[model samples]
Target: MLIDTHAHLNAPEFAEDRDEVISRARENGVSTVINIGFNRETIPTCLELAERYEFIYAVIGWHPQDAKDMTDADLEWIAELTRHPKVVGLGEMGLDYYWDTSPKDVQAEVFRKQIRLARELKLPIVIHNRDAHEDVIKILREEKAEEVGGVMHCFSGSWETAKLALEMNFYISFGGPLTFKNAKKPKEVAVQVPLDRLLVETDCPYLTPHPYRGKRNESGYVRLVAEEMANLRGLPYEEMIQITGDNAQRLFRLPARS
Candidate 1:
């Protein structure tokens, strides 16, 4: 069985046929899905999906793009929700320089707050780094995030960055980019990561893999990502799925599939 370490199955893109999408994922051997809920609008919906499906779990936090909108109450709200048994982690939170929707300083502060909160609750984090690797790493380091190490979701950074994150006890996760023909950096780094420290994802409703690029992504397509990862690591597809699935279970403290 496989686990989609990151996904947005709760996104509006799946509103029309979300059930079908989830069924397809299951049919494709995706046994578990870690869904991200990164902002006021999505947090509730994400939790709903987790509550609705036995195999779905939630990760709650504020997205850097919406950092300016987060308040003390929102943080408290997230803290309260983590008490839910299906809330597996705290994030999808980090710097996002590309969007620049939120000021870099605001994003950094919000990110720090979530990291601090995650540490307080003893929850592993799920990071979202986009065009802000240096600051993400710096803040993660300054905040001593290794205390509750996490996964670098949809990682698109260099090997050097991956190394630093790994040093901080972070698992390096790869998504659709790993399947791209010209994605040299991810391809290069995906092979070097120790199997135990590697994870796979779809980051669905976005980052759709090759052959399906330019189309809306779905959790089912994580199998394509796993296949590509298997090819990259020179392992059988089943073995790659087990390795990444096991890593996901370990990091999120998920129960073994019965």
Candidate 2:
């Protein structure tokens, strides 16, 4: 079985055929998917998808890009949702210097608040870092995020950064970019992450993989990422799938297959 460790199936890109895309994911061996809702708008929709499908789960938080829009009430809403049976984690949260839509200080404050909340709730966090590696790491460290270790979603940083996150007890997840022929850094880090600390995802409807690089992505495409990871690590494809699936389940505290 495979688990898409991170995805946004609630995104408008799949509105036309979300069910079929989910069906295709099952056919492609994706047994579970962790969908993210990173803003006021998506939180409810994210929960709806998870509640609709037994195998789909949810991760809720504020996106760094939308950091400026988040409010005390919104953070409280996320805290309340943590009680939902299918709500598995507390993020897609972190700093995003690339867009700079929110002031860096604001993004950092929001990121810190979410991390602190995750710690309070004892839930793992799913981080989204975009060109703000140093600050992200610094904040995670200052917040003592290791107390509630999480995944560094769609990680695209250097091996050194990967090592630092690993040191802080976080899993390193690789996505579509690892399959790109020219994505040297991600490919390098993908091969080096300890198998037990490794995870894979599609981050679909975005970051589509190799042959489908320019097309819309779906969870089924995560298999391509697993295949590339297997090739890079010199392991059998099925073995790679098993390893990542197991790691995902363990980190997310997912129930074991019967």
Candidate 3:
């Protein structure tokens, strides 16, 4: 089986056919999914989906783009949701300098707060970073994110940055972009990162892989990521699925035997 470690299955794109999208993922051999919460508005829906779907799990926190309009109450509310039985992690949070929809300072401040929250709650984090590697790395280190180790979703960084994150015990997760012929960094990260410290995701409803590059994405496409990982490691497709699936279970503390 495969696990799609990062996905926005709760987004409006899946609103009309959400059930079918989820069904297809199961039919395609994806046993688990981590639904990401990118904003205050999506928190409830993220939790609700985890409750409604046997394979769905939730990660509640705000994305950098969504942080501009946030308030103290929003953070407090997310803290409250951290106690939910199905809330396995606390983020999709980090920096996104490419589009400073939120000021860099605000992003850093919120990122630090989320890191502290994750530690306080004893849940891991799911970070999202883009063109902000330096600040992201500094904040993560300063916040002592290693204490609550997590995955770097859609990780887009040089091998050096990846190595630093790995040294901190963070799993380097690849997404659809890895399958793109032009995506050298992710492909390079694929080759360098060890299988145990490596993970695969669809980041669904976005970054759809090659054949489905311009199409709407779903968790089912994670099989493509698994195939890509296997190709990178020269292993059989089945092994990639098993290893990454197990990695996901271990990272999220899921009751895999259950």
Candidate 4:
């Protein structure tokens, strides 16, 4: 079974046929999906989706792009939601220099806050990083994020950076980019990341995998990502499915399903 460890089915792109999308995911062998929260508006939707679907789970926190808008009250509210059984982690949080919707300083401030919160709650975090790897790693190190560990979602870095993250007890999650024809770095990292430290995601509603590029992505397409990981690591497709699915299950503390 495949587990899409990262996805955004809560986005408006799925509003028209969300149910059908999820059903297609099950048909395609996706046994579980973790919906990630990017901001205030999507947090509730993420929780709702988790509640509505037995196989769906949620990770809630502010995205780096929306860091400036996050508030103390928002942090408290997120803490409250962590009481929910389906709130598996705290994040989708980190730095994003690609789009400075919030000042870099503000982004770092909020990122550390969430990291600290995740530690206190003993939940994993889902980090979102874009053109800000140095600071992200530095902060994670200083904050001692390894205490709770986390995932580097849609990892787009070199093996060296991945090694650093691994040393910090973080799993490296590959998304649709790993399947792109010209994505050399992600492919290289895919080959080097240990099987147990590897994970697969679609980051759906965006970064759709090959053959489906330019089209809206859904959780079902995680199979394509897993197949690509298998090809990169010279393993059978089903083996890739099992390893990555197990990695996600262990990381998110998800129970084994029949």
TM-score of each: 0.99, 0.99, 0.98, 0.99
> For every candidate structure, what is the RMSD over all alpha carbons to the true structure, in angstroms?
0.6, 0.6, 1.0, 0.6
lDDT of each: 0.95, 0.95, 0.90, 0.94
Off by over 4 Å in 4: none
Evaluated at residue 122, the lDDT of candidate 4 is: 97
RMSD of candidate 4 to true structure, Å: 0.6
Candidate 1 structure quality by residue, lDDT tens digits, 1-258: 699999999999999999999999999999999999999999999999999999999999999999999999999999999999999999989999999699999999999999999999999999999999999999999999999999999989999999999999999999998999999999999999999999999999999999999999999899999999999989999999989998999999999887
After superposition, which runs of candidate 2 have C-alpha atoms over 4 Å from their true positions?
none
Model 3 regions more than 4 Å off? none
lDDT of 3 by residue, 66-149 (tens): 878878898899999888888899889999888858999999898998899888988899989999898888999999999989
State the TM-score for model 4.
Answer: 0.99
At residue 221, give the lDDT of candidate 3.
Answer: 96
Compare candidates 1 and 3 on TM-score and give the better one. Answer: 1
Candidate number with the higher TM-score (2 or 3)? 2
* Candidate 4 structure quality by residue, lDDT tens digits, 112-228: 999999999999999999999899999999999999998999999888899999999999999998889999989988999988999999999899999999999999999999999
